[model samples]
Target chain A: MAKKLLTTLTLMASMTAGAAFAGGHIEGAIKARQGQMQLYAHYLGILGGMARGNADYDAAAAQAAADNLLAVASLNAGSLWPQGSDMDSAEGTRAKAAIWENFPDVGAKSMALTSAAANMATAAGTDLDALRAAMGDLGGTCGACHKAYRGR
Target chain B: MAKKLLTTLTLMASMTAGAAFAGGHIEGAIKARQGQMQLYAHYLGILGGMARGNADYDAAAAQAAADNLLAVASLNAGSLWPQGSDMDSAEGTRAKAAIWENFPDVGAKSMALTSAAANMATAAGTDLDALRAAMGDLGGTCGACHKAYRGR
Candidate 1:
């Protein structure tokens, strides 16, 4: 679809700043989780950008981005953010101690993301207004985790 | 599972170089596609590294990595790779003109990757030998694209 093509083009324009990762910061488990997060953010940004008119709206791209976000959200990160790989223990991540210290809350927050992402995936592929609303909910879910677990 | 934990630790040590992305250099469509590839490669590396004994084979990690790979590889890249966003137009990518010139072949190659990735997703979570075989087949599918469409 034309929307898909345009979305892909728009994403191409928006995703540039995310790829310049220094290639030496957090190498192991932390890196994997962070890399996954970067991947998630890029896709979400694409959908959210489109919804806000910050970028062009392409339905296909939005759906795909939402789907990608959903998949990452559902990934089994049980082994990724290991017990000791939080920012306090690692050098390159912003993940806080709360992710492990309160795994239940973190788990609940993660599920919220997955649920929001699912809504976005369906809404994104449908229409702009739906996409916008769904994206806000998903973004809120992300903020919930960052507010409690991500540190500056 | 212990091997998976150790592999994750070793991956942490070996993965430092991938995190050095500068954060400002590449910021558009090409970057999105490349980022997706980087994500794909990271997950594949986890599996391939395990298969080769270069890293410990943690069944859970391997399965999760494969699932992640399948998810990313199966993403709707429709907008991610736009017209004129090839390597010739982009600075940090290796996609060749043949991708557009031989669109059908490119489509086929992409589908091949999807098929292989699906197999990997199914095999990785089940057993080690299945993971190894599926990975080789998936690698071959990747090579098919590089052989026909990618540049050095």
Candidate 2:
């Protein structure tokens, strides 16, 4: 019964993502949003690499990457996240249904990322110690959202 | 003789990249800067995808990607483009020696990117036509820089 209910909800949500754009194609939506997520990962990986000493830290480079994160975070994301495009409805997506169920919270999380990125950008160009401190806060913010709202 | 002189200059420039962070590893420097460029590509690709109609346009998404490009472009880049780490020195870099030979021109090109990105951020979310026009300018600015300073 639980599986059946989930299947029905998934179909309904998929419709929401597809129908949001009217003439918009669902596959394109999925690809665009997923691509955005991949961009996030590419930059975050650079920042993390510096903090971990896995890659050398260049203050300018660090600053740029941090600023990029903040810029991405500040975007209005609603259009990219149509109601049904969660992992359930989309292929290659890991977003959970909770993103729609508690969108306000998701928004709060996005804001948190922005705040964290701002902090990181300020410190990233100063010194490694400062960057390391800011990195911790930024990572925590991202992890919190993923833990609460994203799917496995 | 020109080829040999060029090889000598390449080695000398590579040393500059290696020496920038006294204790830093050269391979790490290469990775870090290359990674930064990749992030730039990632964000720019999104903006371009919208402009090209290869992907669905979501105003919010376009704006975010444009903003991301602007932020990345605004960073101090000297550290990333350490004197020696051009295509000649770094294993995976495509940077041209001309970047070091005529750094002022490189700076000029960078400024062009900044200008174009600023315009893009302003128009990307509000008007597709405006975004399209700005996108052309932005792409042209990038091309100008690559043509002068990046290796084929």
Clashing pairs in 2: A13-A84, B13-B84, B14-B84
How many clashes in each candidate?
Answer: 25, 3
Interface RMSD of each: 10.2, 7.9
Candidate 2 lDDT for residue B22? 33
Q: Sum up the clashes in candidate 1.
A: 25
Best candidate according to DockQ: 1
Candidate 2 residues B25-109, lDDT tens each? 4445555555445546656766776778776776766776677677656644544455656688667778887777875566667
DockQ for each candidate? 0.12, 0.10
What is the TM-score of model 2 when looking only at chain B?
A: 0.80
How much is B7 displaced in model 1, in angstroms? 36
Residue B78, model 1: Cα distance from true site in angstroms: 1.3
Give lDDT tens digits, candidate 1, residues A32-69: 66666766766776776777787666665566667777
